[model samples]
Target: MQKNPGAKTIEGDLEEALFHAGAVPEQDRGCPKRFDWARSARTDKGVSAVGQVVSGRFYVDPPGLVQRLNSILPPQIRIFGYKRVTASFNAKKFCDRRRYVYLIPVFALDPSCHRDRESVLASLGSENELVKCLECSERGRKVEGIMGKRNFDSKIGLDVGKLESGISSNNQDAGTTEEKIKDFSLGANNGGFDIEKTEEDEVLVQDVNQEEVKAIKKSDFRYGEEERERFNRVLQYYQGTHNFHNFTTRTKAEDPAARRYIISFDAKTTVNVEGIEFVKCEVIGQSFMLHQIRKMIGLAVAIMRNIAPESLIETAFRQDVDINVPMAPEVGLYLDECFFSSYNQKWKDSHEELSMQTYAEEAEDFKMQYIYSHIASTEHKEGVVALWLHSLNYRNYPDLRFINNNVNNDVESLGIEAKDGEK
Candidate 1:
């Protein structure tokens, strides 16, 4: 469903591979075929899935079916094994819940990693470079006097004037030099960034496009303990049922499908990949629309980076406020697993449990070498997250400005504040 030119999708690739393996007859390969293929979840083009389940009618005449499929399928995709299920089984319809994981470099959420470069760019009047990284919709409406530097009421929480002054004073001593500019574009940290890279991971640095590589070398950005904790807090905002019309496309607030229940959304742990530290954020929900996971991650990251206020998220769930939330890159997102506990329980006596636990180790290895490595390598080269952060600052969504200027009223109207004794 996620389009990538000249690439093979799991659905398309599996359909063809089955044909080659003699499981799908040549006649069934055409559009008006007798068999139907269905997957538990739809993944984006670049997104990887280690525990995806697909159901289809297959002819299991001969032995070595799994071996034959593997031999014909590409290396990137492999079938661990299969089990015969009931005739009424439908992968998507019977799935109870879905889990997803997103891998993000430490620097993406650490403001200190980007602060100095942002200051340098501002000083050089080259801030436009950051604004042009992505296409964002202008909200058109503006709050009167919100654009001017003003002291925010302390009762509402964040002090805008003081926050601005603090950042300015801290960076006042930061000097712009030709070398620093060069290093800024290349994301080199001068002993400040704390991440380490392996020798093989370092190879991606060479031959990177000068234009694309022109970013604050973020490797030096230290994603300390405090920063990680704060980011986790930011992620907790999406942990309940909410209208997520803004998080995906072609959906309106009034649409019943826009309402989704999130079981848990949290930053579970950090993993070292090719010397770069990536935080693994896992999300569990009953169902998700297209781009829902990516947009949720994007809004959370934007809030963490201070490009958007925390209240913007609450406002997005309001039916009247339609904010164009950004979608995070698909490279880091993957379908971790799907659950069918209810179905399995009812048929415990007959059918084997439909689960990926048997192949968990192989799945982890595939995700590490193929999925995680590709994410790290691509991020190190393209700096997609870094560029996206810059764009968020310039996007100027009306809801962001509205909430910033009227935090108290916004919170009161939305009723997002916790009831007494709730937290």
Candidate 2:
């Protein structure tokens, strides 16, 4: 789901690219449309997908096909491999699950002056130095508190009552499961995801709910082993169905549409060139609403920072509960994979179902070089996550307007487009 402001969708551009490149025939695609095209996910600006699948008729054979498509596509977008699927298959309908990986730099998690609070405070033992650190933290928390309630809907203006009413209802299953999710990590090596690692822990019982937790590893993180354990445990809270109204905009707390099922969430530590450990978090789920994943990570980070209570998660899931969820940067997020087992089972004998393995190895390498590097570079401008955490301890906005507030909460209706197509 690649996007460019003031430009057509990546899907539309791809069709044109393929047609002009001699894949979709000009005649077959008439006013009624010659070939069918469908995609599995939708992404907002600054988002990238490495294994997004789309179904359409192609004119070329399997050999040298990837090279041919890449020749016509832009440098930012690449054509991986293609697989022929059964006629009954629809890319959007047959898809079962979507997986995402959020990459974080270990150094970014550290406070501006030092790796952590104790380290920062210890280096500045004098009374004057202690006061300065507190002052900086106080200022940062002001922004973080504001960001917790900030969202596309609030910025655009939406009716708060209807939004909460819609999501808080019993219907929004988001299709997760009714089972409880558990945290079971073994050691600090796998991206700093150290757990009990006992044989009993390894023998995880497979229930309908456990089956959904797909991601079992993590990425680079800057926190210590203690923080890593807390981070992993916090992920389990998001495993089953929950009211995610606070995570997205323009949705009611009771809205059934607000419920989403998270199958798996895990983390590990990765060391950057400077030797700082960055904990990378991976979450796989049935699907997510707007800004849901980022908020989850943001809240998790705040908890690890000891700025917010883990009880906030429990409150967030309750009906009509208002919780501030600081949003994580989108730069580190990646659409790692999508599953279509429901349809794949029927067609596995024919091929490996629909996948992007053909160019996966190369495409991922290119993403790390071009995409991840740029995200890390731009991060220098402002440490969004750190600033947000600072706000957890303190926030002062006398005139701030939030939908969850009890009194004089104005409901303004405005036209906002919903991109339910991509994740």
Candidate 3:
């Protein structure tokens, strides 16, 4: 049986009802009751199920069993209803995909304090630290793991070229030109390259936004060149269908049971409305082993911290490799979403209706609490002003793109000059 953490209370209540109805024995009337012949699938605590299905044989009448179960279930964890499928139907085998959605607050600090004056001043100098700290927090780290696959050593860099290669290999001629066109469009919009043209009378040049250039320059937010290349190598090694046993944490005896699958991972950084920045990583896979995501996030964090050697990722990608690195924290992680080939229309419709109702109620309660908090804090205008000031500084800071570009150019040239000097 698969259990949902969020439904524990309701599950317990239902168990009691089942006991009363003689569906369960007196000794088996508790939350973690064990049935001698049944197998269990364990899931993390606090994880909720939306449309999970389970099957079993019972001596009691099916309709009566279901009705009794529903009667004791809490409104928060209601059973939407169920249907009988073919006798050969297997809930796990028939599942095409599983999706999870995680709601994350964009900015780390209190949203209201962002408008204060003192906050604005502090934000300008402390923005990077704040972002790093927030992301390093337990919840942030956990969410990062949920976003990707990684080696047991906890390395999480993605191989974009490898992903593209896999897709190409599968369909051969599929999406090649279309992918190039999309890439070109995105690159052009992001100012990835410059174009030169000459008119009949004179040469015209497109001007780059100095502020944008500065922002790009100031954003020292990615792996170093050598580190990035090593990461790419690791990704290339893992491309296509290959057993990921070595990349996962498991006992030697379990190696024979390990599986191979395809995975696509992407990472990018974006600035939010509040001027706070974040790194978002998305990973799609046929399936993943235990702790795969956590390990990957841990690797990424290590790379970001300049602690791990870049080649470590490549080594970890090898077959039967034993990567024993600490896994990253889980609080920052979220099972963002799942995908399936198709969904039941009626069930989907009902689920949407129920979700909307729940959200509406929650929204009303939140609004009331917010109003009360605002009124209670009215006298603390000084503190509020400080926070607002911090937010403003974040929004109005001068772009650092020019400085960054100059530094990068100088570094490159310095290397060239040094080589010549050595000669």
Against the true structure, whose TM-score is highest?
1
lDDT of 2 at 196: 32
The whole-model lDDT of each prediction reads 0.59, 0.51, 0.32
lDDT of 3 by residue, 1-423 (tens): 133455433234434554564555566555332432121111243222233333222234433444454455333333333333333333344344433222112222223222333333355665432222111112111111211122122322211110000000000111111110100000000001122322331222223355323322223333435534444443343345555554456534136545545455544332222222333444555555665555554454343333344444444444433445435433223333233333334346432211213233433332223221221122121122222223233223211011221322332332222222222
Error of 3 at 196 (Å): 66
lDDT of 2: 0.51
True lDDT of residue 191, candidate 2: 8
Clash total of candidate 3: 43
Ranking by TM-score: 1, 2, 3
Q: Whole-model lDDT, candidate 3?
A: 0.32
Point out the worst 10-residue segment of candidate 2 by lDDT: 162-171
In model 3, how large is the Cα lDDT of residue 156? 28
Off by over 4 Å in 1: 1-7, 115-224, 395-398, 402-423
lDDT of 1 by residue, 1-423 (tens): 222356544556566767887677778884313565566777655566766776767765466666676667556566766666677777778889999899987767865343333333564555434411111112111111111132222121111111000000000011222110000000000001123333322221223246534441323455567777777777877889999988999987789999999999888589988766888999999999988999999888777766677877776776655576867877778778788888889888987787767666766666776667767655544455655554555433334434353533544453344333422
Error of 2 at 190 (Å): 28
